[model samples]
Target: MTLSEDRVGMDPITFCDASMNLTYLGVKVSPWLGVNISEVGSHLEQVLRRVGELRLKPFQKLTLINKFLIPHFVHQLVISIPSRALLRKLDTSIRAWVKEYLHLPASTSNGILYATNRDGGLGVPVLEDLVGRVALRAGVKYLLSEDPAIRAMATHSVLQGKLEKLADSLGVKWPCSLTDLKRVRKQQKSNILRAWAAQKVQGATVDIFKGDSVGNSFLRQPSLLKPTRFKTALQFRTDTAATRASLRRAKIVKPGEDTCRKCGETQETLGHVLNKCRSMHERIIKRHDDIVKILSSESLRQDQLTTEEAMLGLTGENLKPDLIVLSQEAVFVVDVTVCYEHKGFVGMARQNKIARYTELQRQLKSRFNVTHGEVIPVVIGSRGAMPAETIKGLKKIRLASKGLLKTLSLSALRGSLELYHSFMDR
Candidate 1:
């Protein structure tokens, strides 16, 4: 309602400038007072652009109305905007005066979002559109600093880094501004961007987490299905604490077992456990030999010998068998059960590990030309713990990893070596 005498007081003023500071409401503010109102209209338009950038909607301008403008500018004004018909009549009344006094642009002839006074319209300022955006920028900055849940992810480098890339892809040019508008000024040196990012993330929320292909592969105790099933596996490293610990603990041989059971002198290493541990599986080995003897006529040719001699080439650096050893017509891939006691490694992780072991087993099968058998996952702890990979694709044990083959449970029976010898003898 740009009546010459009515312009005064606060409200998201319909327009303000030149002689236009206080409206009918009781307030007075403005340096350009008494100046023609038409002169300041263009400046108000530029101010509205700043409002749009802040993303504030028009309605919220009601709160700041009287505070910034006249004391009662909008206090008596109806909250609703004037209808189109009323606006048209007002424009008709001002069109000639505006056209002669203000050099109104012609491009906006039929537009009120911006309009040309030359086309029978009042080139009034659009104040309602500008205030909200200014409010929005302020709101964004406040939310970033006040929220906690958002900070959890902001502190994590990987997730925060990824979100920055994602924000860029969305055309949100300055990543931090979208996430945290406070970062727009580039005021600090350390990662203020990261700290403010907490606020930005808190401003957005996700309704769901954990997808379909999550931790469905790993074998964890009680089996939680998150994506980090291989949590322990991921901790493995090239050196230092985690990797060294993993190497030391993920064993087929017992943790403290000493000398090679076959020959007292060769100090037992992880390699020795797979090949020369005498106390490891005496019963299983006996059973395996007996079965092999019964399965084929080539039993006698296989060696039926003492532990020390048969295990000569089983351990140490030189004794490493290639993948071929497991596939030999009569060889058994053996792993003393120690995997169960060390960690409650999830099933999905176990499944992956078993898969890898199976691949090595397959390679050995091709090389050794041996009758294939199952990969035996045995538990060698004193607690009598036995962990089995329950997943369908990884239901068996892996007798060899990297490359040491020992006797499979079913392959160690009495006469097993005799049976292998018999087949070879033929």
Candidate 2:
């Protein structure tokens, strides 16, 4: 039959004609623009519903969103790119859900929401960013396919052309094969991701210490089942506790509670309470002594280093080493102290403590008649903060294992928390 004669006996629906919108396989196709955004929107709605239903901690919620929610949308992202407006809406809904989950104020910065866990953030994955990442990954897979059909499809794809153009624009050598493309993609992704995180975490109170085993270990530790324990660990790691300065910074309390009730003069900060507060002298001494004891026990077990001796005072001076080790190669004077977790300050504090004991080291060397002597200063922050130098020193001294460092870091944090509570009571 002719086309006009066929239409004479049939309605649009009877002929299976699509007028404005058509739904097939969960995707809504628009006839005019031939765009498939409704499917993405529906998938995003399901993700947001699951997010809203979760009754979990901030970190747990973040984990769920990244693991479950992102993947659900990414399945759709693999097929087509969601419009910018749709992406923005999805982001808004997810952020709102996160804020609701955490009971955060409306004013919380998006930067804090998306920053890395090490940068003292909840580290919620961004939907827009995840979509782009998934698209790039899909493109990489297509380029690596051995099937003739897949290879031909990739060669004709707009994404492949764009990638080549991007390489040329950046002065990067255009990738010729799947392996070279994968390598280039990996490098580009690493640089982009690092820069993205750095931008978000810039000017943040928390500091980043790359290649810091202690920090990495703490972050990688097994999850705490109890919410309280989990939150305490997270707070200590992120520096988000209800410290006087933190409270003041959040404007949760005014100038009244901002000042140290212990010293009654200086502003109470995590650094001050952990390091410089004179009122907590006894507790600080006990904390320092406790950590020293642990080190001494470890040092004594080593055959190369002799038994560690503690509280060795320099005659006619207030200078005293917390622990001293006599190794066959060198005499090691170790001084342990608690200080701020700030990366910059931790190094300075370590160096300052080492410098203070230089004269004492000389005196001890002279008295002991030791030719090779070195001072090893271990400065741990009250909140379980360990300096990179301290980590290196610990490893150098044969205490590098993950279990040992993790135990040490956790112990210091618990001890510091107990001391912090006592100060609060005072």
Leading candidate by TM-score: 2
Return model 2's CA RMSD, one decimal: 6.5
Question: Residue 252 in candidate 2 has what lDDT?
Answer: 86
Candidate 1 matches the true fold with a TM-score of: 0.17
Deviation (Å) of 8 in candidate 2: 33
- Tens-digit lDDT string for candidate 1 (93-199): 33322222222222212222122122111223223322222233433343376567555535457544434443343234422454343342222211222332232
Off by over 4 Å in 1: 1-218, 221-265, 283-426
TM-score of each: 0.17, 0.73
Best by lDDT: 2
TM-score of model 2 (CA atoms): 0.73
Instruction: Report lDDT (CA) for all predictions.
Output: 0.29, 0.62
- Model 2 agreement with the true structure over 294-358: per-residue lDDT tens digits: 78788877854543443334445466576767666567778787665664777787889777777
